[model samples]
Target: MHTGDVTARLAELLLGARCPGCGAPGMGACAACAAGLRRMQPFGVGGLPDGLPPVTAAGAYADTLRAVLLAAKERNALGLLPLLGGRLAAAVARLVLDAGGIPSLVLVPVPSASAQVAARGVDLTTSIARTAAARLRSAGLAVEVLRGLVLARRPEDQAGLTRIQRLANRAGAFRAVGPPPSGPVVVVDDIVTTGATLAEAVRACEVGDRQVIGAAVVAATMRGGGAR
Candidate 1:
């Protein structure tokens, strides 16, 4: 069974079927929460971190979307993958179109530290990326997922850091392993608060002599903030 399947099953056994967005009783998402997710009509997100590429988001990081993402991150809400994965797939399509219709694509997930994976019992980024890739492939798009990037060094937790501090902490923090990604690449992550992490992923691809076409996120913090 997939790790997501195991996690979701465990959650159901321990806590019953509950909506990741509203905590109402249901599998994956309750009908109301499912209705809450949709593609942003204007998909482009502004104010990227320096050196970050043009990107798209499934939704702003607020409301029901915020609840769902945090559920997948903090709780074992893997049952919600179908919903979240759909959101990510829409974002990737928008990004590909913005990049002038890339012929084919590889999705590279930003790695979560081994410690985080151990503590959480799931790699949220990779799981979601694979889910999105599966959805894209079913739609007849050529999509692949590569998950070989690792953090070169550990940085302090980013919760309270200023934008500049985040950039400093993650600078040169990622490197690709097991040969580098080739063909057009799109870096995938669950969320983007300041884009520090995503920029580093792009840099890692550059270091490996690859260029990221753009990035796609399940959601992004839409509040105003500038990156240095």
Candidate 2:
């Protein structure tokens, strides 16, 4: 195992498993916190960027979901992976059913920057995508995860950028790492903020002639009148 993995495991063992949402000691999220996360809803980008594929989120990025995502992404709260991944799987299932129930689909996660991954010791979105793929396979759907996208260059941090600024900054920021899949490609992401990153991902896949059906995300931030 990598030193980082060993350290994370050691920390988990020492700290014991506590709910990221409630801090209650147990395995993974507590029942009450899990119940709160059960409220999955479809969301759309309000000021949807051009070239962005149709995207649907499983739930709003707030409350317990927000806490859990932050814990998983920023704090190395690995226990929340299963719950978040299950939510992503549910979203992918819905999208497949809406698209006439394809027998199989390829899921491509939006890649994180190399520097960020080095610092975090894990690629949060990719890890969740893998877990989501496993859940989908268990449910009898043929799911394939393609790590096809990579950062063409590191862009500025997107913490507080406006939609237009984000779009400009992320333009041409991603490129496909290999030949794109022939079947439908669904970009999976942890969050859809301004839809810029997902839009760039779709563009990268299309560069290799991949048919991007849509995108699936764990959560989305509601803006304007709310997601459609």
lDDT of 1 by residue, 1-228 (tens): 877566656767786967767776556776677876963542666777766778788888888898898888888777777788889999998887777777689999899989879987888888889889998888888998987688998877888887788889998889888776567789888888888898888999878876688888888887662111
Q: Pick the candidate with the highest TM-score.
A: 1
Q: Local distance difference test, per candidate?
A: 0.80, 0.81
N/CA/C clash count, model 1: 0
What C-alpha lDDT does candidate 1 achieve relative to the native structure? Answer: 0.80
Query: lDDT tens string, model 2, 1-228?
Result: 876555545656887756677776555677788987776665544457766666778888887898899888888777788899889987888788777788888999999988778988888888889999999999999889999998888889888888888888888999998876867899999988788888888988889788899999998877641111
Q: What are the runs in model 2 whose C-alpha is more than 4 Å off?
A: 1-17, 43-46, 225-228
Q: What CA RMSD would candidate 1 show?
A: 5.2
Best by the lDDT measure: 2
TM-scores for every predicted model: 0.88, 0.87
Error of 2 at 201 (Å): 0.6
